[model samples]
Target: MIYRRFGRTEQRISVFSLGSMRLVNVPPAQAQATVEAAVAAGINHIETAQAYGHAESLLGEILQTLPVPRQQLILTTKLTPQPQDQLRESLQGSLTRLRVDYLDQLAFHGINLPEHLQWVLQEGLPVLRQAQKEGWVGHIGFSTHGSLDLILEAIQTGSFDFVNLHYHFFQQRNRSALEAAAQQDMGVFIISPADKGGMLYHPPQRLQEVCQPFSPLEFAYRFLLADPRIHTLSLGITQPQELQTAWAALRDPEGGWGNVLRQVQQRLQEREQEHLGTTRCAQCYACLPCPEGIHIPEVLRLRNLALAHDMTEFGQYRYNMFGQAGHWFPGVTADCCTECGDCLPRCPEQLQIPDLLRETHQLLHRSPIRRLWE
Candidate 1:
């Protein structure tokens, strides 16, 4: 596997790291085999979280049987920033679950709001600091699904050694945050570059045509890897076979891969121009702070994907996540957009914001049961 300098930590972390969230529901033997396969494939960095159900415990069991020493691997797990009294207990639980004496990295999980950040600074950081002092935590960082402004605020604090956020070809909203993290020399780990990064695992035919020669999933990985600012991309693997495509992408000769990346990007741009015409949303957040608390840009982007790329299924799935995702996705769906026109002037494209929102809602709104299942 390809490795990169993980900023100030200075570890040569694997560019393709294993994310344990998907392992929580898998059979124990399957989970163990998957972890073993990843380790054998040189994925030294493993990320998990206390919030991911039983992922930590399952990974802990597999790690015990690995041939490598515990110190030879980089292990990271997360916990939500909690009340001062509950912090150590939470940390101890994670340690016990992972069967580790210490964590290579411990993040304030899901710092997705201003209040979450405040809690981490006031109640959480102190506990993490004590854990660090005791050598139970090696580095402190945060994982976020917050707005770019909030993420930048968190990084600018200079309180972290690393960060995990979502950034991919389709979801470039966090591009500025990635740049800021690089400027701070903090390790930038991208979350969900595949599934949430446009559902490339089951790419629509149009996207496949645009990303010729490479599967949409491989293209997504290459797109992120091309940016030097990104250190690693999380692969939420449930089976060993999922690792092969990524390994193949990594095996490409550097120069050849660079050429392919450029070609794919050019093709994607051409496709966008052809399919979206002039009425497409640029994904600029200037139209934000929606008076109705609707996430205008995200909902419209989902609309564009459905209309432009004929990715209706993916678009519907994501659009329905609005209310369900809570703070992680934040904001109401397009159905909440009032005809207030407050966002119209802010939009550089001069698109009819409310009308488009209504159209999006009509196309992608799901029943309560369907949303829950998804």
Candidate 2:
């Protein structure tokens, strides 16, 4: 397993960190086996959150029986931004549940709105600072599903040691946030790369073809790790097979995956160009602020992938998440587009904005699915 120094924290974190969200509904024995397999495969960093049902307690029970010493593991947990008075109780509860005295990192989980940031800065941060002073926490950070502007603002505060956010092959809007985190020397951990990275775990045939010699899932791993700014990709595994699949992708064989990585990337671009021509969504967010609250760039991008790469399932999965995901994926579907011509004048590509929205709605709309987080 490849390990990288997690920015200013100086902890050598495995490129593949275990995320415990998927294990919430799994049996304890299965969860323990999965965790044990990950540790055996050299994944030192394991993260869980209080919101994940029974995950902390399950991990605590497993950790005690593992042959590996506690010091060798880098354990992290998150708490929702809470009242100052509730902070101690929340932190202590997490620690007690995880069978640990101090946490490697404690993040303000899901600061996805502007108000959440305000709470973190004014109220949440002070209590975390006190926890640090008492040696209850080793480092402080936050996980966000907010906009790029909000993420940039949070990094600029210089109060965080690390950050957890989403950045993958299909969603590159947060690329600038990765750069900002690097500038601050903050540890950058990607959230849900496999499942959220265009649902590559069960990728369409066209996507598999474009990513030749590597499965779409493997390609996603290589794509993220190519950028040194990314410290780790959180793998939310419910079974040991998932971890093995990811580990196999990380292995360097003979001449290595470098040549194939470039080829696969070029093929992916070329395939999209074949169908999209020049009208492909650049994801520049220039066509934003839709009058009806549509996420134009994301919807159009999903449309591009679905039409060009046969990623219809991925499109449906995300498009259906419009109203269901709340702030985590804020926006209505293109069915809400009012065609005000407001975004038309702003677009640098000068594509017919309303027409594209209508097409997107036609191509990807589906019955809403329950958000995995919920």
Candidate 3:
């Protein structure tokens, strides 16, 4: 139950924040138990969003029953970027749904595209700032699933008191963004580390073996928390038992994980090198400007993990998200590669780009799972 100061907001948020998106998908009783379990585990920060399908409503019912007082918990919610005039109503709606008069934090949800950021600065911020002045909201921030450039641009704006974005062991692509947030003194909340972080919740045998002395989930948790830039990791819980299970694995009693983290990292690297050889994707993002708009590094990274560590489940899970996730995961799958040889010259490794793209498609492509919203 380690707590970190969430940057400029100065709120001490727990290392793990309870996320409600998955809760809304489960039965109400389970959801209530899960929220109670999270609070019992000392998770003070609870985040929900307007787009999360009655999650706020359920929390409204559950919060009234919790033993803890309302003022003691740090409650947060988000709404999409709205027009200036509609922003107050949107904020009030979330308040009504949560049965709360004020929020500890309010975020402009899903600023994943450049246009979304533009709208937030031009139309949304004024209303949100007013809300803050009016005491309906405390701190202002945003959540993003956009490119590195877009994230960097948003951080440079210096308007946010915190940020909720993706950064984990498997996806260190956003490492620079994490550093930038630290520079701005902004709160850094990591979203979906166990699930989107290579589906470590049900990790492959190779990953399990490589992360010796710690489960994949445990290693992922430790690895992120080791970095002081990260303030909290969002845990999506649908049931009470899920929270218990995860926290049980994450608790380190002896407290000598630094040495273990180093050892396991070496093993993971060696495993990648053993199977991937020299053609392994460096993840440099140098092989960009693919005329076909394929996200080359991500595709090949997934391919490397699947081929090297038997992480086919994780690979397929993300590969299938190609077009369905919209701006959240914006890029076509490698099956759309046109063999133009455009990215080849840009790649420092000079690996067989088109051939690898075809291989990625063959190895990981599958029927798209229904989108989370669906």
Candidate 4:
């Protein structure tokens, strides 16, 4: 596996870092096997977050069993910075959960909002710097699901050591963000290059054509890594087969992408539609002022993404990370819709409000959510 310098840090992060959020959240034994396979395959970087249920704890058990030296590993973890003061405690708690003392990289988790980034810079970064001084964290970074504009804004900060953002064949809006990360000498880590499980199986034919000579996965990975600014790619691996597949795919990417494209063509049929990810919600949020305190736009965004991109887990992740926890100052759910039909006109997509709400409610509260939370 090729490794790259993670920003200015002394660590050489693997091009493929083990993501413990998805696969292992379902079963500890399966998670262990996946990590073992990655380690045996020469993967050195392992990333998880304190909020990711028991994935962190599972990795700790595996590390103790594996004979992998502590110094030989590049561990990255994150903490949500809402109650900013709790950021320190969160980092320490993640280390304790992972059975590590000092995190190789401690990134601010889930700052998809520009105001949040500003809040983090003004409030959280100082605490992060203090952690650095205290030797609790080696480097600082953030993982985002925001627009390219917010990403560019974060890159311009000149503060973060790395940038963890999303990229996929269907989603190239962040190309500029990748460029800015390179210019700033910050490590650009692509999170969910497969569109949060959307591209893993196969992508639409039109997308395939644009991403010619590449699978949705390879096209996404290569597209992001093509930028010298990018340092590593992280996947939410859950099984040993996936572990082996991603590593093998990247070994010689030039040819593998084409192979993947052919596989996509053989495996899935393509359908054409304009407003690919926006037919439902587009996340425009133009329909604010809901009498009930529900985050209609945000919920719709996840729904459209879940269906449009086939991100089977994104709807669950969004609910787990946002809904279950009242992180939005005040959060809302589908039950609040009241079938009022008031939001229809304001919706840019004019999606079927009640029907979509029913689906969103079902997806958000599904039993499988336990898979992501362990």
Candidate 5:
């Protein structure tokens, strides 16, 4: 595997770190097999979080069955809420599940407010320090998707050893944050690179063309890691195949990814044009479980993806959504929306819900053939 020095640390980290968040509800065997595939492909960095729901347990089973020694791998996980009891419970539970006694890095997860950083310093620091002192956690860090201002403030404080931020094609505003972390020589991890602010999902064809010459994963990984500030790229690999693909992508030795960076940037610009001043529902899914069984967000997302990416995939997914309505996603019918006022204000964007429903209905019921060419 190709390795890069982890910030100022002597340890070499893989460019692509395996993330286990997508394995939510997956059987332990599947999770374990996924990890084994990644490890076999030379990925030594694995990242996960407590909030990922049963992921730690699934990972724990995988680690126990691994044939390699525990010290050979670098595992990173998170603890949120910062309460002593909750922190302790999370660590112990994670340790028990991973079947390991220690963690390479245990970061305080999802600190958005500046006050939350203070909470970590006051309450969470002691616990993490104790864990480190006792040999339970090797290092401490925090991941934030909050304000860039707060992130820069926390980095300047230098209270933690590592930080994870969202940086990608669509959101390049965190250069200052990366610079701040670099000033202290702390490890910086980038999250959701492909979907930062939902930019990479159904990017314009120009963007797709930029990456068509190479893997979009490569474009993202190379772009984020080119600066010495980034130490790791944690990706949520759902299946074993993705693990293998990432392995080869990161290990490409010429240290180049088909030289598509500039093209991809140009493509991202065109893809960005369509959403310049349009209003959009953030897809928070808070407007869920419609009493009338309207699958509002799913239909909207598929429609958005159709308009954003290739309609072929959207048509295919819609076909499946229709074919397996009661099976794949139970009670998510497009026809079930009753113009009810229930799911309206929950949206932070204040989109016209009834109009959106009309658009979604037409898209879903439209001929699949036309959708493919559109």
Candidate 6:
């Protein structure tokens, strides 16, 4: 496994981290085998959270049977911000489930809003500080799916030792946040690079063709690994086969991957140019600050992806997520566009903003799926 310096934490973390969310519902025996395979493959970091159902408990059972010493493992778990009085009890429950006395890292999980950040500062920080003093917590950090502005706000507070957020090839929205975290010398862990990163696990035929020798999933992994700012990428695994795939991807050297990446990227651009012509949204954010609180740019990007790359399913899934995502994604969908023409003068591409919004609404809106968890 490839290792990188985890910024301020100063630990050599495996570029691939074992994410425990998917293990929550798996049979115990299978979960144990998956964990063993990951550890044997040299994955030193394991990340879980209270929100991931029974993941911590299953991991606790596996930890006891592992051949390696406990000190060699870097364990991280997170808690949502709550009243100060309840913080310790909640953390204790996680500790009990994990069968660990102390956590290498504890994060304020899902700090996706300015209000969430305020709650963490007002009620959660003091409790986490106390835990750090008591040796129950080694470091304090946060994980977010918030807007880039909110994420940068949290990073600028200088209160966190590390950050876990979304940053990948399909979604470069958080690129600036990653740079800001690196400047603070904070460890940057990407949340989900496979499932949420364009669902590369089941790639479309065109994407597979363009990516060439590399599988779509491996291309996504290598794309993120090419950037040094990212410390680790989460491999949310349920089966041992998934772990093996990730291990193989990480073990593949970076020598020729760069050239391959450039070729694939060039091919993607050429495809987009051919299909989308000159009227596609540049995603420059100038058409933002919509009067009706519509996420105009995001909606347009989804539309462009669908039109440019025939990624209709992927686009539809994300477009449907807008209203349901609440503060995490924020803003209504293109249906909220009122055609006031306010965004027209601001758009450098001069594409019909309101018209595009209407087109997006038509192409991407569909019956929403109930999220399994928040």
* Cα lDDT listed for each candidate: 0.86, 0.89, 0.88, 0.70, 0.68, 0.86
- Compute each candidate's TM-score over C-alphas: 0.96, 0.97, 0.97, 0.70, 0.70, 0.95
- Candidate 1 lDDT, tens digit per residue, 150-255? 9999999999999998888888988889878988999989998888888788888888887888888898888888888988999988899999878767766485
Q: State in Å the error of residue 236, model 3.
A: 0.5
Cα lDDT tens digits, model 5, 201-271, are: 44446435646655565566666666677877777766786654455455553545445556666664455
- Residue 135, candidate 6: how far off, in angstroms? 0.7
Candidate 3 backbone collisions, by pair: none
Give per-residue lDDT, candidate 4, residue 26: 62
Candidate 2 lDDT by residue in tens digits, 1-374: 99999989999999999999988788888998899999999999999999887889989888899889887888889888788899899899998999989898889998898899999999999998999999999889999999999999999999899999899988898999999999999999999998888888898888888887888988888888888999999999989988866876787833235787888888888888899998798888987788789999989989888988999998999998998888888999888988788999889988898899898889888788877657
Worst 10 residues of 4 by lDDT: 268-277
Residues 136-227, model 4: lDDT tens digits? 88889888866567778887989888888776544455767877887788877777666453445455554545445555566556545545
* Of 1 and 3, the candidate ranking higher by lDDT: 3
- Assess candidate 6 and give its lDDT: 0.86
Kindly report which residue pairs in candidate 1 clash with one another.
none
Cα lDDT tens digits for candidate 3, 177-292? 99899999999999988888888879888889898788888888888887889989999878777775457545673463477788898999999999999879989999997878
Q: In model 5, what lDDT does residue 25 have?
A: 55
Backbone N/Cα/C clashes per model: 0, 0, 0, 1, 2, 0
For candidate 5, list the clashing residue pairs, or say none. Answer: 60-97, 60-98
Candidate 3 lDDT at 8 equals 96
